[model samples]
Target: MGITREIGAHYVQEKGTTFTFWAPDAEQAEVVLHVNSKQTIPLQREAFGYWVGLAEDAKPGTRYTFKLDNDKEFPDPASQSQPDGVHEASEVISHTYNWTDQNWKNLPLEEYIIYELHVGTFSEEGTFEGIINKLPELKDLGITAIELMPIAQFPGERNWGYDGVYPFAAQNSYGGPEGLKKLVDACHKAGIAVVLDVVYNHLGPEGNYTSSFGPYFTEKYNTPWGAALNFDDAHSDHVRNFFIQNALMWLRDFKIDALRLDAVHAILDTGAKHFLQELQEHVNHLEQQLHKPFYLIAESDLNDVRLINPIENGGYGLAAQWMDDYHHAIHTVTTGETDGYYSDFGKPEHLVKTLKHSFIYNGMYSEYRKRTIGTDATANPAKQFVVCSQNHDQVGNRMLGERLTKLVSFEMLKPIAALVILSPYTPMLFMGEEYGEENPFQFFVSHSDKDLVEAVRKGRKEEFASFAWQGEAPDPQSEETFNNSKLQHSYTESEKQNQLRKFYKELIQLRKSVLKKLCKEQLEATLNEEETVLQFTHTSAGLRCVINFSDQPQTITGTQGWQLVLNSADTKWGGPGSDNYTSGVITLQPESVLVLQAKA
Candidate 1:
């Protein structure tokens, strides 16, 4: 009955509904409701370019559209459900739900072991209900939180979700509003928090009609996708309210535990109060009102600590952010990839520096950008940075959409996993990385425009020029491409795959047990002369991890008091067993990780 009701259609029990629209530019605005009969209701213009109207005959399940100035009708920009598609009418939905997670409490930020997955490809069903069925398996896999790729309503049945046109609408193909609520409810029941990926930088090219109502986008600054969102332009007050309300809708109405803002670096805003800072302030108020924890994690390429820094320190006060440098350092080292951004990495010292300090490029000159980049983030806690060896962008953005399993050997994945899970920062895993999923998570879309489809394909091909990857990119508009990206889920049948899953589970168990009590200050990482051998010590836990990144085995010293806790190269983990320690010296197998603990 507050901000949610102020925008979009709000249905009142046994009392019909109230419809609102923001169309300052339009001379007229009317709600064309599709009920038992075609009903046209004119809305009364309100202050600050808003139109409000009450329809007693309209109730939940009523489909309608807003016609502006005798022009073509358009779906609600803040639509709760776009059942017919992005091009069709919007349906009225009730926010009421029988939530059983009243007593559900979220895990601390440090305790989050995030597993990021795309809903459409995560399961064969490819629905919210599909994810519900897999909740038990995820809970068992030591995943404390599941970060879903953007689920806002996109053009068609399939998309990576960055093309979402309706920011407030639940993707109709993914079971719409009711289905999303059910999945969130189920996740909480399984002791898993839900982190939703949201794109606030720019709307999709197709089916974007927000400009028809008012100045929703500005031509002043352009984004990689299109014109940047008008956060600091004229009529920006309503534009800011639109996105802020959308965030509130996800957290308040759907009960999402956290939001992973997609590409905040592209959100160009030159205002007194930054959009991110303002959004965080609103979320803080909601956290107080709900008496629960809700976090905002940003995906930013800028490498600025101001995003997670406290508001008192002239920062945004976000809980966490995705640190891409950590992934780049690890990927370049393990895969021997030195293309594009990876060229800035590949040195073993880069990974060592990343392990010690979350940002490898903190206030340093970046060879890739040919400019000084990043701010010092060493003052921030390790939990404020989410590190992953493989994520959606890293895997899918490749020319072939290849995962780490495709690029690196089976043995190499163990050390990469150890580096991410055992590191001081919060760790995240891409879907199927736990069990060595072989399927590629290719990018796919279902847009209606044929010309736009061709443009997208061309853009993707051109984007790979810098990486210099050979061959053509898979067709994004092809249904076969989307189908090819689905997880096989047959890891249980494969011996090696199941073993990899077991290895991951063991590492996660260790992280939750001994490593959980250790802070960033207690962690120290060092590299040998050739930089092929890497070792990190957890002083407080008396735990040590040694990794061999070279093709051949390497010997390392200073292990007299430590006993073997876990050996990834052991025969049990589907690897050739390495030689046991002798007289404080040990030979680490090629591409293997060793975990040791102080003997009692």
Candidate 2:
């Protein structure tokens, strides 16, 4: 009864290709194969509102569309390849590929040092092939996992990929489904697991035809993007199956080791079994069946510990959740920005609590939300929380999309890197953050609808008005804005950036090897509010990270036999050599950090 067998177009060499669609509301359905000699084949309606037929003329590379009610023609809702456009025919793609990762095993969640990158902006080429050529660079940089932003098909070539309308199809502009598979296969060969960001809460407004096919969305609840998905509605089984099948396709067909569900807080459902739990169960089944380790990381703003709690404990059983609290606490302190949600953070105590516990607001009053929020996540493993100093949303949603490199001094950036990589939680680095690329990650989209484009432009302006940020918002519709967001690959060629990259690689090496044993039980922190100096200790591991945020040299004493393992102020790490520590005291330069291993 699993819907994965034959939901989309599947090719059988002898029988050619068979197309299947779930259109319960349609009076009639047919397949319009857009080959040189166009052929229309009437699909026999099956039980449960499914229309199925064999197109003997259709094979891999054949373009086709579904005709509903004998009148309207639209691309398959479960399209795998939209080569022309979202509005055009869905191409039949062969899943066969020369994959050499049959013996590849993905790293466990605890070992993940994830590097999140948008395929379109990670390189100048902005394609899956472009990303393949850089796999060695990421592998050599010590990245265990690569998290790609949403790659589902949208309207045009330029998009952050959140506007994806075709959940199953790979963006035609990004070289379609085959391109994504090649990238995934290549990543596995390089010993890097791939975590794809998937949006299931709501579909984009443009080129969305799922509603016409069946009850795919519900008006009972609304999401920030649009109407919420039909998870609890009356004909919701197929709707759930639609998404379940999509997730399966990515995991089973593409061999992606993990999925990062975007904004789980936005997914509205009142069902007895929440869609998240159901999806988790499905993933679990796949893991057992395929004998592969899989993970599901949720991006939730609700601060609900239940999202990652065990399934037996009446929770969603997610592998991990994004620890935005850590980012907020770090960003507020380093940049001293107290606007928006940062107002809830910025205190040394706030960061200390986040380091000790996963969430600073666990069962505490939130002034920003004007209510008590979150539950204790301290009991969860440190790896259950994915922490990052900077990500796409934190930077792209800003007025000018200024990265951490733009917000803080070169000396300040290393401490930020150390705080994240050395933390107990799983660490994720935004693309180019390792080498300190100066280019901003501005939001850009290329929607074909003129009216929708204007609406997005206006909405962005109004959204930033509340942030109280200066300067005009960049045009999301402009080619220059998209180009500006692309990372400068040549930045690492410079002496300073090359050193920073080396620093990141060394930190990653220490994390995976020596620091692997670090746990919350071994954690401790000493905060000096007056000098803005924070000393965090891993007592059991005999490790300590001393950070100086003050603008002047600060002295910290009482370290008898601690050996300086790594220092951000070292000349090798783009710093004016170490300030030097002697006896039981160490002099820390302004805006520098030091990692010391206590001698046994």
Please list the Cα RMSD from the true structure of every candidate, rounded to 1 decimal place: 1.5, 1.5
- The TM-scores, one per candidate, come to 0.98, 0.98
Question: Which residue window of length 10 is worst by lDDT in model 2?
Answer: 1-10
Q: Which ten residues in a row have the lowest lDDT in candidate 1?
A: 1-10
Poorly placed runs, candidate 1 (over 4 Å): 1-5
Cα distance off (Å), candidate 2, residue 289: 1.0
Residues 1-600, model 2: lDDT tens digits: 233435879888878998999988888999999988879999999878999999887999999999998788988999999888888889998777788899987787899999999999997789999999899899999998999999999988989989999999988888788899999999988889999999988888889998888888888986777678888887787788888889989999899999999998888888888988988999999899999888999999888988999999999999999989999999999998988877898887777788888898888999988999999988888899999999999999999999999999999999999999999989999999999998999999899889999999999987776576888899999999999999997645699989989999998998887778667767997788584888888887788999998888888889899998999998988898776678698999889999899887
